[model samples]
Target: MRLLLLFFTVVLGADESFITPQEYAAQLYHNPRGIGCHLCHGEHGEGKVIAHYIDKGEKKAFEGPPIRALDFRRFDAALNRRNTGMPKYFLTAPERKALYRYLHPETVKDAHAEK
Candidate 1:
Protein backbone atom coordinates (compact mmCIF):
# COMPACT_ATOMS: atom_id res chain seq x y z
CA MET A 1 0.00 0.00 0.00
CA ARG A 2 2.81 2.41 0.85
CA LEU A 3 4.50 1.65 -2.45
CA LEU A 4 1.29 2.29 -4.37
CA LEU A 5 0.83 5.64 -2.60
CA LEU A 6 4.38 6.64 -3.34
CA PHE A 7 4.02 5.78 -7.01
CA PHE A 8 0.88 7.83 -7.32
CA THR A 9 2.47 10.78 -5.54
CA VAL A 10 5.47 10.71 -7.83
CA VAL A 11 3.36 10.53 -10.95
CA LEU A 12 1.12 13.34 -9.81
CA GLY A 13 4.10 15.42 -8.81
CA ALA A 14 5.57 15.03 -12.26
CA ASP A 15 2.41 16.41 -13.78
CA GLU A 16 2.67 19.50 -11.59
CA SER A 17 6.25 20.22 -12.57
CA PHE A 18 6.82 23.33 -14.70
CA ILE A 19 9.68 25.25 -16.26
CA THR A 20 10.57 28.67 -14.87
CA PRO A 21 10.27 31.84 -16.99
CA GLN A 22 14.00 32.36 -17.04
CA GLU A 23 14.44 28.84 -18.30
CA TYR A 24 11.88 29.43 -21.02
CA ALA A 25 13.70 32.55 -22.11
CA ALA A 26 16.96 30.67 -22.20
CA GLN A 27 15.34 28.03 -24.33
CA LEU A 28 14.22 30.73 -26.71
CA TYR A 29 17.64 32.32 -26.64
CA HIS A 30 19.51 29.13 -27.39
CA ASN A 31 17.04 27.98 -30.04
CA PRO A 32 18.62 27.53 -33.47
CA ARG A 33 19.07 30.71 -35.51
CA GLY A 34 16.57 29.92 -38.28
CA ILE A 35 14.21 27.60 -36.45
CA GLY A 36 13.52 29.25 -33.11
CA CYS A 37 13.03 32.82 -31.94
CA HIS A 38 15.73 33.89 -34.33
CA LEU A 39 13.49 32.86 -37.19
CA CYS A 40 11.45 35.98 -36.65
CA HIS A 41 13.45 38.17 -34.29
CA GLY A 42 17.11 38.89 -34.97
CA GLU A 43 19.92 36.83 -33.49
CA HIS A 44 20.70 39.27 -30.71
CA GLY A 45 17.02 39.92 -30.00
CA GLU A 46 17.61 43.24 -31.74
CA GLY A 47 14.58 42.72 -34.00
CA LYS A 48 15.42 42.13 -37.65
CA VAL A 49 13.60 40.49 -40.51
CA ILE A 50 14.56 36.98 -41.46
CA ALA A 51 12.34 36.77 -44.50
CA HIS A 52 10.84 38.92 -47.24
CA TYR A 53 8.16 38.58 -49.89
CA ILE A 54 7.36 40.33 -53.16
CA ASP A 55 3.76 41.09 -53.92
CA LYS A 56 2.46 39.28 -56.97
CA GLY A 57 1.05 42.34 -58.67
CA GLU A 58 3.24 45.03 -57.24
CA LYS A 59 6.71 45.62 -58.61
CA LYS A 60 8.26 46.39 -55.23
CA ALA A 61 8.98 43.91 -52.48
CA PHE A 62 6.92 44.10 -49.34
CA GLU A 63 9.21 43.88 -46.37
CA GLY A 64 8.03 42.56 -43.04
CA PRO A 65 8.96 44.18 -39.77
CA PRO A 66 11.62 42.70 -37.54
CA ILE A 67 10.54 40.05 -35.08
CA ARG A 68 10.46 41.86 -31.81
CA ALA A 69 11.45 39.18 -29.39
CA LEU A 70 9.76 40.07 -26.17
CA ASP A 71 11.70 42.86 -24.52
CA PHE A 72 11.23 41.64 -21.01
CA ARG A 73 12.25 44.92 -19.40
CA ARG A 74 9.55 46.77 -21.28
CA PHE A 75 6.97 44.01 -21.00
CA ASP A 76 4.44 46.03 -19.07
CA ALA A 77 4.51 48.81 -21.61
CA ALA A 78 4.59 46.50 -24.59
CA LEU A 79 1.64 44.50 -23.38
CA ASN A 80 -0.37 47.64 -22.94
CA ARG A 81 -0.06 48.63 -26.59
CA ARG A 82 -2.86 47.44 -28.89
CA ASN A 83 -0.97 46.69 -32.06
CA THR A 84 2.63 45.63 -31.92
CA GLY A 85 2.30 43.13 -34.85
CA MET A 86 3.60 40.24 -32.78
CA PRO A 87 1.48 37.18 -33.23
CA LYS A 88 -0.08 35.62 -30.17
CA TYR A 89 1.94 32.56 -29.28
CA PHE A 90 0.11 29.29 -28.81
CA LEU A 91 1.86 28.60 -25.52
CA THR A 92 0.22 27.58 -22.31
CA ALA A 93 -0.10 30.18 -19.58
CA PRO A 94 2.74 28.68 -17.62
CA GLU A 95 4.98 28.47 -20.66
CA ARG A 96 4.26 32.08 -21.47
CA LYS A 97 5.06 33.09 -17.93
CA ALA A 98 8.33 31.24 -18.05
CA LEU A 99 9.31 32.86 -21.33
CA TYR A 100 8.50 36.25 -19.88
CA ARG A 101 10.66 35.60 -16.85
CA TYR A 102 13.56 34.33 -18.90
CA LEU A 103 13.58 37.29 -21.29
CA HIS A 104 12.97 39.97 -18.66
CA PRO A 105 16.21 39.68 -16.73
CA GLU A 106 18.28 39.87 -19.85
CA THR A 107 16.27 42.76 -21.26
CA VAL A 108 16.54 44.64 -17.99
CA LYS A 109 20.28 44.24 -18.00
CA ASP A 110 20.45 45.41 -21.59
CA ALA A 111 18.19 48.40 -21.02
CA HIS A 112 20.29 49.75 -18.19
CA ALA A 113 23.65 49.46 -19.87
CA GLU A 114 25.30 52.28 -21.80
CA LYS A 115 24.74 51.59 -25.47
Candidate 2:
Protein backbone atom coordinates (compact mmCIF):
# COMPACT_ATOMS: atom_id res chain seq x y z
CA MET A 1 0.00 0.00 0.00
CA ARG A 2 2.81 2.42 0.85
CA LEU A 3 4.58 1.56 -2.41
CA LEU A 4 1.41 2.18 -4.39
CA LEU A 5 0.89 5.53 -2.68
CA LEU A 6 4.45 6.59 -3.35
CA PHE A 7 4.24 5.55 -6.99
CA PHE A 8 1.11 7.57 -7.51
CA THR A 9 2.57 10.58 -5.74
CA VAL A 10 5.70 10.51 -7.89
CA VAL A 11 3.71 10.13 -11.08
CA LEU A 12 1.36 12.96 -10.17
CA GLY A 13 4.23 15.17 -9.06
CA ALA A 14 6.00 14.63 -12.38
CA ASP A 15 2.87 15.69 -14.28
CA GLU A 16 2.32 18.64 -11.96
CA SER A 17 5.82 20.01 -12.50
CA PHE A 18 5.39 20.12 -16.27
CA ILE A 19 2.13 22.06 -16.42
CA THR A 20 2.03 25.84 -16.49
CA PRO A 21 0.83 27.64 -13.38
CA GLN A 22 -2.26 28.80 -15.25
CA GLU A 23 -3.15 25.29 -16.29
CA TYR A 24 -2.71 23.94 -12.77
CA ALA A 25 -4.80 26.74 -11.33
CA ALA A 26 -7.45 26.26 -14.01
CA GLN A 27 -7.85 22.59 -13.13
CA LEU A 28 -8.22 23.34 -9.44
CA TYR A 29 -10.71 26.13 -10.11
CA HIS A 30 -12.82 23.94 -12.37
CA ASN A 31 -12.84 20.99 -10.01
CA PRO A 32 -11.36 20.88 -6.58
CA ARG A 33 -12.27 17.61 -4.94
CA GLY A 34 -15.78 16.64 -6.18
CA ILE A 35 -17.19 20.13 -6.85
CA GLY A 36 -16.38 22.65 -9.54
CA CYS A 37 -15.92 26.18 -8.34
CA HIS A 38 -17.22 27.49 -11.66
CA LEU A 39 -20.55 25.83 -10.97
CA CYS A 40 -21.21 28.47 -8.33
CA HIS A 41 -18.68 31.14 -9.29
CA GLY A 42 -18.66 32.29 -12.89
CA GLU A 43 -16.32 30.88 -15.55
CA HIS A 44 -13.77 33.47 -14.53
CA GLY A 45 -14.80 33.87 -10.92
CA GLU A 46 -16.82 36.96 -11.85
CA GLY A 47 -19.77 35.53 -9.91
CA LYS A 48 -23.09 34.24 -11.21
CA VAL A 49 -26.71 33.77 -10.29
CA ILE A 50 -27.10 30.10 -9.45
CA ALA A 51 -30.87 30.05 -9.19
CA HIS A 52 -33.90 32.29 -9.00
CA TYR A 53 -36.81 31.71 -6.68
CA ILE A 54 -39.72 33.42 -4.97
CA ASP A 55 -39.72 34.03 -1.26
CA LYS A 56 -42.83 35.50 0.39
CA GLY A 57 -44.12 36.64 -3.02
CA GLU A 58 -40.79 38.31 -3.80
CA LYS A 59 -38.35 37.10 -6.41
CA LYS A 60 -34.80 36.44 -5.26
CA ALA A 61 -31.64 35.21 -6.87
CA PHE A 62 -29.20 32.81 -5.28
CA GLU A 63 -25.80 34.04 -6.31
CA GLY A 64 -22.13 33.33 -5.83
CA PRO A 65 -20.37 36.61 -5.25
CA PRO A 66 -17.47 37.77 -7.41
CA ILE A 67 -14.20 36.32 -6.15
CA ARG A 68 -11.92 37.76 -8.80
CA ALA A 69 -11.75 41.15 -7.16
CA LEU A 70 -10.95 39.81 -3.71
CA ASP A 71 -7.48 40.10 -2.24
CA PHE A 72 -5.64 36.86 -1.48
CA ARG A 73 -6.19 37.17 2.28
CA ARG A 74 -9.96 37.54 2.01
CA PHE A 75 -10.16 34.88 -0.69
CA ASP A 76 -8.15 32.40 1.35
CA ALA A 77 -10.15 33.18 4.45
CA ALA A 78 -13.43 32.54 2.69
CA LEU A 79 -12.33 29.17 1.38
CA ASN A 80 -10.75 28.02 4.62
CA ARG A 81 -13.37 29.25 7.05
CA ARG A 82 -16.82 27.70 7.22
CA ASN A 83 -19.61 30.01 6.12
CA THR A 84 -23.30 29.83 5.34
CA GLY A 85 -24.43 28.95 1.82
CA MET A 86 -20.95 27.65 0.89
CA PRO A 87 -19.57 24.20 1.38
CA LYS A 88 -16.65 23.42 3.64
CA TYR A 89 -13.83 22.87 1.18
CA PHE A 90 -11.01 22.33 3.71
CA LEU A 91 -8.47 23.12 0.99
CA THR A 92 -4.77 23.28 1.68
CA ALA A 93 -2.73 26.49 1.44
CA PRO A 94 -1.34 25.60 -1.97
CA GLU A 95 -4.78 24.75 -3.33
CA ARG A 96 -6.20 28.02 -2.09
CA LYS A 97 -3.26 29.87 -3.67
CA ALA A 98 -3.84 28.16 -6.98
CA LEU A 99 -7.55 29.05 -6.96
CA TYR A 100 -6.71 32.64 -6.20
CA ARG A 101 -4.21 32.71 -9.06
CA TYR A 102 -6.84 31.40 -11.44
CA LEU A 103 -9.09 34.33 -10.56
CA HIS A 104 -6.22 36.83 -10.79
CA PRO A 105 -3.81 35.88 -13.53
CA GLU A 106 -1.91 39.10 -13.08
CA THR A 107 -0.45 37.64 -9.89
CA VAL A 108 0.95 34.65 -11.68
CA LYS A 109 4.18 36.42 -12.48
CA ASP A 110 4.63 37.50 -8.90
CA ALA A 111 3.98 33.99 -7.70
CA HIS A 112 6.60 32.58 -10.03
CA ALA A 113 9.07 35.21 -9.01
CA GLU A 114 8.63 34.27 -5.37
CA LYS A 115 9.57 30.68 -6.05
Candidate maximizing lDDT: 2
TM-score of every candidate relative to the true structure = 0.39, 0.80
lDDT of each: 0.50, 0.85
RMSD of each: 8.3, 4.8
lDDT of the structure predicted as candidate 2:
0.85
* Model 2 agreement with the true structure over 11-113: per-residue lDDT tens digits: 9999878777778789988889857989888899989899999999999999988889988889988987887777889788988988888888886665454
Candidate 2, poorest ten consecutive residues by summed lDDT: 106-115
lDDT of 1 by residue, 1-115 (tens): 9999999999888754554444446675555222465445555455665445567765553233442454544543443354444544445445444445554464444432321
Minimal lDDT window, size 10, model 1: 106-115
Q: Return the TM-score for candidate 1, rounded to 2 decimals.
A: 0.39
Which runs of model 1 end up more than 4 angstroms from their true locations? 1-21, 28-35, 56-88, 106-115
